[model samples]
Target: MMKYLRYALLAVAFLLCVTVALANRAPVTLALWPDTVTAFLGFGYAVTLPLFAIVGGAVGLGLVFGLVWEWLREHAQRAEAAKMRRELEQMRRAHPETAARGATQPPRDKVLAILDEADGSS
Candidate 1:
């Protein structure tokens, strides 16, 4: 089933990540400036972290940025959808009779409506 296949895939991915982490357990120094620049500036920041941690952090940051970018790009669509919903509500309130009739109307397909009635599942 799809559920089992998905679980197996997830397991494989987890194992791969674990293997990578174990293989890259050595500490890596992350420096903000070159040695010469640091010497001239008299101040530089650096942190030592496991290579796996750095790699994972970069991947996580990329995902976060991508999500934010997409949300920003879709802002207009979201705003338009909200505007249309408000307009629909206003129209529904303005014409209560039409809204009621629309709700009671049968499906567009006459054959489907007949079948639904016959099955008593309309």
Candidate 2:
């Protein structure tokens, strides 16, 4: 049911985008700089593209930049998580009794219990 809902939402979004593209079919000129600045510098550039293409390209670029920024911002948290995992693994290796105690304890969930049993058997 959730999967179907997600698909439905995606379809709606696609249709919306298609409608926007069709509605904004006019060509627009994009310039790197103003006409005066270009004349003074003698190195201005411009390109003609559909309005939808420009808007979509800007949105796509923004999404990519946001993703990259978020990933970079979380670098410290990711590093700390990795460090904790390594420390936990080292502690488990160093203390056989604690590891055995943990293994002997029954899991709270049926799925986890089944997984533990499978691990023990293997």
Candidate 3:
């Protein structure tokens, strides 16, 4: 599933680049830093196309990064939780005193029995 999603993202990026290249065929002059040169850049033909690509690529990369970061973080958290759970289980298994005390704690039956006796007296 992850492999397929990666392929889909790649295809989308390719299509976007192709679309930009196709739509922007003509060249126009660019006014770069400290120079108003007559240099013809392809992007100048359809300014919106490259702008869309740049913005979309940045956003797409950000999404992928965030997804990976979240997955890693969640994985780490689950691993830590699992370790703690295992440690607690081990302690419970090793300590007979703790288990005995926990088991010896009064059950609900005693409370119900006391209530029954009180009701009978009343």
Predicted structure 2: clash tally: 0
User: Which parts of model 2 are misplaced by more than 4 Å?
Assistant: 107-122
* Local accuracy of candidate 3 as per-residue lDDT tens digits, 51-102: 4555556689999999999998799789999999999899988997998898
lDDT of 3: 0.74
Better of 1 and 3 by lDDT: 1
Per-residue lDDT tens digits for candidate 1, residues 15-113, read 999999999999999999998999999999999999999999999999999999999999999999999999999999999999999999875898886
Compared with the true structure, what per-residue lDDT tens digits does model 2 show for residues 1-122?
99999999999999999999999999999999999999999998999999999999999999999999999999999999999999999999899899999899876998888999999998
Local lDDT at 5 for model 3: 100
- How does each model score on TM-score? 0.83, 0.85, 0.30
Candidate ordering by TM-score (highest first): 2, 1, 3
User: What Cα-based lDDT does every candidate model obtain?
Assistant: 0.97, 0.98, 0.74
Candidate topping TM-score:
2
Which parts of model 3 have CA positions greater than 4 angstroms off? 1-57, 73-78, 96-122
